[model samples]
Target: MQIKANNPDEYIAQIPEDRIPYFKKLRQTILDNIPKGFEEQMSYGMIGYVVPKSLYPDGYHCDTNLPLPFTNIASQKNFIALYHSGIYASPEILDWFVAEYPKHCKRKLDMGKSCIRFKKAEEIPFDLIAELMQKLTVKNWIKIYEQTIKK
Candidate 1:
């Protein structure tokens, strides 16, 4: 199915009927936890919750318009993915997450310099993830973003 949702509502409406619930839950988790600066948009054909350019101009790898230190929630053919850049950028937080949610880390996390990919929505520990998300406040995120921009 071609999901071409323009706005947040439309984007969500395009989600496969069967996966709507999962997507909604994930979306709510991100919405409830992140700060006000974050923007939700369609990115890479998936619902991406980003910390807009004004907040992190050099997103991930200098993509000014893209948001960094954010999460990308995508609905795939068989499962959902909750991609967290913080997992890669901050080892301390990642380690804490792993230690706290061992069951979710049974499989090796597919990570980059700034992303953690989960195959299923159930794999994500919402409460802990929420806590971790909160840790990346605007103040702290800006400091980290600035440091990364320098390099």
Candidate 2:
């Protein structure tokens, strides 16, 4: 949803009540497993895990004022969306995630280039997401971003 939140907690608070637990768990999953150097914040109106500007002063190429986004989770109108920039920039990571999805969840994988959409709340594979979160560090991500995505 289009939550007018100023921070990650505010974004979580603004999500629908029924989804609060799911969102919270998703947030915790990322927080618990994400590599160091990624800070939590509200990014693009969603709960974002990012490389803060302090660490990477260049910031996101698309918007230098914003932190370098690594991943984001949002409660969308129809589903929960997880956006992972690493998977978008690295084919090896993408292929690994794709191959491993079915092993973690029963539902068919519903995904885009960088967005993984979960239509059913209970079907979200938090463990898989946690594993994905640990795959990249700020240094690795910036390198990949520079080599494959930054323009």
Candidate 3:
């Protein structure tokens, strides 16, 4: 579905009727576990929660303004996507997710970076997903971000 959200609120409102429930649940999951020093906004036509440059001015890649640690949630044509930089930055977290939630094997997890896709709401491991979300909050993300910046 097409999302015409120019801002975060509009983005949340623009979610297609069919995908509203899933989107809402996912949105709430992220909001409920939001970390400190992070700002929520709309980026790449999706709902993105980011760690501002002030906290890590050089957080982005290639000197870009994009924040190093963030999560992006989007409503795709056939599925919903939840993107988190945390997974790619923390092997321990990613490994635990893959090991504890093999049921998600059918789901598309873009480990290449940090995007995880689910074709349906039922496909998502809500509890596990929330756990990861909490672990990846701005505070924890900074620690990982620092390690990454050094390398």
Candidate 4:
């Protein structure tokens, strides 16, 4: 995706006007549910929730200046995409998401590794996503991230 904005608001503004409402709803849920120390910013041309540099001075291994990415939300051309490192890194979480999504939402779960692609806002299982978000904290996420890197 193109890096169209440097900040969250700018990123949201760049979203197709028709998609703004869905993005806003998802963004707010993310902000409200994410564990503390995760900073909301524009990354990979989307709204990203990341572990701040203050919490992880080493930053992301791929880009030390950039904070470690936790999750991201983007309004793609055809759908809304949610990228979550926790779900990708943990098989248990991934399984839980896959299983619980259908139980909670009527739409079929459309996902790949860490990315959940929803063609429409209603297709998103917001409650399930919130539950997943609440499952990990900055400390827990860093530990998991490091473990993945070591392997």
Best by lDDT: 2
Our model 2 lands, by Cα RMSD against the true structure, at 0.8
Output the worst ten-in-a-row residue range by lDDT, candidate 1: 109-118
Candidate lDDT (C-alpha), each = 0.67, 0.92, 0.74, 0.85
lDDT of 2 by residue, 1-151 (tens): 5989898888878778888898899999999999999999888988898999999999999999999999999999999999999889999999999999999999999999999999888889999999999999889999999999997
> Model 4, stretches more than 4 Å misplaced?
1-3
How does model 4 fare in lDDT? 0.85
Model 1 gets an lDDT of: 0.67
Q: In candidate 4, what residue range of length 10 has the lowest lDDT sum?
A: 120-129
lDDT of 1 by residue, 15-111 (tens): 6787677678878888899877878887767677776777666665655555664667776565566676666566787787767666545666555
Clash count for each candidate, listed in order shown: 0, 0, 0, 0
What local lDDT does model 4 show for residue 102? 75
**Candidate 4 clashes between residue pairs 3 or more apart in a chain or in different chains:** none
How far is 26's C-alpha from truth in model 1 (Å)? 1.0
Give the residue spans of candidate 1 off by over 4 A: 1-3, 56-61, 67-69, 103-123
For model 2 the local lDDT of residue 133 reads 91
Best by TM-score: 2
Estimate candidate 3's alpha-carbon lDDT, on a 0 to 1 scale: 0.74
